[model samples]
Target: MDAFICAGMMIIGRGISRGCIGARTTCLPGWAGVASSRRRNRHRVESSARRPFGKRLERFGVEQGMALIKDEAVVLRRLDFSESSQVLAVFTRAHGQQRVIAKGVKRATRQRASVGIDLLERGDIVFSQRPGGEERLSPLTEWRQLDHYPHLRADLARYYAGLYAGEAVAMLTEAHDPHVGLFDGLRKYLADLSSDEPGLLLARFLWLLLTEIGLQPELSVCTSCRRLVTEDRVLYFSSRSGGAICRDCEPASIEKFQLSVGATKITRGGPTDARGVRAALTMLDYHITEILGRPLRAARSMHATVVKSVSGGG
Candidate 1:
């Protein structure tokens, strides 16, 4: 009894010796039970904290054993990364703009059915991104070519136009936000670039992109006063006002381009000759430059390749 008291192992009132509930007894299981209760409480709090995000993760298509994401993407730019890898900036149909590092795609021995992740190629890509909210580069595991525009690659004019489209899409769209219609429009435009008039096609592409993003100018009316534009007097294409302005609504302080009668008719989807097409292209370019805050690099190249060719041929 003295040894038990010295050991401080005996309960004074809760239990007696020899496992009876009375004074001068020891009980070890009660101590273990208190520790177990603390552990259980801690686990419950942690599990509750994780429940919401876990459900969201499931909604984002994270399966039980898989973390891969799949999407169709158009390659806009490619950069060499080590000896056997390449990093790509692509506009995806499902994920918008994404930067994915394609591992081992640069190696000569890596065989796949795709066009090898070159610039301006549309393909299916499977990738796994990092878990955090910050922008992290993902690993591209598989690539299979879907639409390869060989003609655009072969022609410098068409290639630059396609690059301009890709750049606009990448710059205007937000990451991981799907824009299916825009993706389809770009795919169709690139496909038709080789056979169509390159200058007109590019101008149309810019128009489509601007319209889809809600930035296209008010073509049939005065942007300043919302008046229906008519061929009544000399009109001005106002870059500052974002549309054609009637004579009364034109501001003296703002610089404006004179709208040809033909250009005015073209805005209403009327019959347009070659001159009207040029005028429309010029108006669209000014508006696009206003939105982008700078001239496109490909636009300069296209001036020589597509614009000059159209002018020279006409």
Candidate 2:
């Protein structure tokens, strides 16, 4: 009889566990809902448990197990998740772009050891990846800031440029696809934003970004005729055609931007000219906008920076 009773209890207990996992409020006649004793209002836990299995698992960070992932990352953006937690979008040197949950990060008594989770900040982070988890949001366990880039925040134009670069990386690059070269290049670009020729640097970085993404414009040859784009005369850049075009191949129906010989020469790493930089900026702006299907918010700021640089030089 004792063995029979124990077997019945075991069966009943498993039924309750399955009911809880399934997120049902009631489980048959004799079973009570699982409740959290720590909370004054038990409805919170009860209601939370009533959600779908996937959602409940994500909320509790429960899964098969945790896999440790340690990498150097550059902070891209952060969103407030709960009262005490934050969701961070970061570009890791080894893991590319990812979303991480920083729990208790906003608490006043939280421990901090050189981990600044601010936009455009670089940091070394330790996180835990949940196997067979919902939403795939990893939990950030530790962070040690590498670079704060205080100079960028001090200057508005520089800050906007940095924002642009970070946004581009977050938007263009695929998540979890490691691009260490692009990550390193962005770090160097941010460090050099305070240089004397920032516009030129930005233009060059934009060109590099295009090249890294395999969307490099054909500056050496015409896109249509495949003929060499000689530096003898003026050139026409067509967004629709994807690159420079000769006069014969240039479509009259499609609008194209005229590029002076100096501008064309600069694309091939010639000496930098203000006109060349501006022209390069224009062409890249068009190309990127075409590919992205939307204009970059920093384009206006970039144009303003160019005007200021030109006027300041004069």
Candidate 3:
């Protein structure tokens, strides 16, 4: 009789474990019911573990995961990481600035020699990153070169101008912040560098970049006193005060430099002559240097190249 009762209890427990007991049916008494409930929970955990990682996260209400992104980009800087890899700072049109590591990009095979990435090269790029990992370097999966701007390499002046532009973009723009207009302007500037005069092209580009980033100084009014500045007035530019200053306001500014009427007019979108353009670039570069807290490494060399070109022309 005891054996018969134990067999019946075992069968009931198995039925309960399989969820065969409906709401209308009575649950097993005490420890048998508890054991069945524990088995169900364990089974659920094992089932969950079998699902994909992304789905498992979704079950807990987490939606973000590793994502792959594609965009058009220009290489601003490149650093060799290993014999077969490189770290690149690339400015993308839609995605803004990104620091990514290109693995095996420099690896040599029987097929092709490893040339690696070059600064100022434009290309389409595909990279992978995790959500909330913007501060970390992304992994670059693929790259297809589009434009080498061959003219930039042929002329030393154009090459330095390109370098200066790359440095400015890298230093001034924020990571992951999109500047579509600025990107277009940069592309145009690079394209025009071969035929256009480097100095004038660089000046226009710097002005556009400054305007895009909201760093362009106040040109028409005194930044200190908010007074209207006229063409004849003795004008001073103070990067610290945020723009042009009148004579009276200039004394109050600790950091300032006198500006020529032509340079001032050119900076405000007026007509640009060759002499005025050079002066404009000088003033703009001054402001850029002040903002960066140091001089651009390429600035001196680029200026020298421009001056030499001009002197040779004369």
RMSD to native, candidate 2: 12.7
Q: What does candidate 1's lDDT look like per residue over 1-314, in tens digits?
A: 10011001122112122223223222222222212232445564345335653342333223233346778888877788866667888888877888877654544321112223578888777766655632777766456567778888788878887887787777777777767888888888889986987767767777777777877777688888888877667788877677788888786628677886556544354324566556666677667777778876676776667665554334
Which sequence of candidate numbers ranks them by lDDT, best first? Answer: 3, 2, 1
Q: Which candidate is the best by TM-score?
A: 3
TM-score of 2: 0.72
Model 3: lDDT of residue 220? 80
Model 3 over residues 1-314: C-alpha lDDT tens digits?
A: 00000111233334344254332222212213333544557775446446664564332222346576889899999999988778999999999999998766676434345677789988877776789888988867557677878898899988988998889999999999999999999999999997978877887888899999999988888887888888788899989888899999788788999986556765656335666666676788899999999988888987787634542223
- Runs in model 2 lying further than 4 Å from the true structure: 1-64, 110-116, 132-135, 252-255, 310-314
List clashing residue pairs in candidate 1. 15-22, 16-22
Evaluate residue 106 in candidate 2 and report its C-alpha lDDT on the 0 to 100 scale: 55
Error of 2 at 276 (Å): 1.3
lDDT per model, in order? 0.63, 0.65, 0.73
Candidate 1 ranges with C-alpha deviation above 4 Å: 1-66, 110-116, 231-233, 253-255, 260-272, 311-314
Error of 2 at 4 (Å): 57
Better of 1 and 2 by TM-score: 2
Which model, 2 or 3, shows the larger lDDT? 3
